[model samples]
Target: MGNLKSVALLLLFTFFVLHLPFVESDWFINYHIHVTNDLPLLNSPPNQPNLFLHCKSKKKDLGERPMVKGQDYTWDTKVNFWRTTLFFCRASWVGRKTIRFDAFVADRDEMTCRHYHNSCMWSVREKGIYFSKNNATWGNMYPW
Candidate 1:
């Protein structure tokens, strides 16, 4: 009986060790959005829109934590903007898609969030700009 117990313990330990890597295989990706409020130009003419961003996406490293404004401030942008792009990856779409975005700031305001939010902001980590209006309308540019 003692020998049987020892064998079972050893087997369990081996099983856990072997599956450790597989259990944690899910890697994380971060995304950021750089937006220039341009509140100053809010009153500017429509042609010369005041609202502008440094670029599209701006990626950063935040270990494995969710992206947050005050917590995660280390930005990665080639062009400067008003609010720094920030984000982190998380499981989404019922585990189908690995969604990544700024923890604090969203792509668009509350009203437009559901339909066209992701497109409005850029993903820093993914290095891509998102636009709800037309996903294909954005220009190809490195995340700054």
Candidate 2:
């Protein structure tokens, strides 16, 4: 009986060890993109009338949002556990005066925060592109 119990314990331990890789961890990770266009007026269509926010992984478009003049747009997207994602928060609509931010998120809790409001910000301020972890603080990103 003692030998049988020892054998069972050993087998259980081996089973768990072998299946460790198969076990998926519930490490939730997501990125929130807060997009804003403070412009009073967008350039004429075909000349750059709007700013686009797009995110993707492996060249696949996960989701996107468009920022119009005088309003804020927030987009949320899930990140594949530990997979790098490319975030294109700004795109040209009319001319060189447009502000855009292209950001990347890697496999880190600080970088891949699953639950956070406005993890990143892409906005146009004073005719310039700005990025920030929060809305209260801003960092110069690009020239308008």
Q: What TM-score does candidate 2 reach?
A: 0.54
**TM-score of each candidate?**
0.19, 0.54
In candidate 2, which residue pairs get closer than 3 Å at backbone N, Cα or C atoms, i.e. clash?
47-94, 48-93, 48-94
What is the alpha-carbon RMSD of candidate 2 to the true structure?
6.7
Q: Please provide, for model 2 over 119-140, each residue's C-alpha lDDT reduced to its tens digit, 9 standing for 90 to 100.
A: 7666666557776665667677
Model 2 spans with C-alpha error above 4 angstroms? 1-26, 42-55, 62-66, 98-100, 107-109, 112-118
lDDT per model vs. reference: 0.34, 0.56
Candidate 2 lDDT score relative to the true structure: 0.56
Our model 1 lands, by Cα RMSD against the true structure, at 15.7
True lDDT of residue 76, candidate 1: 33
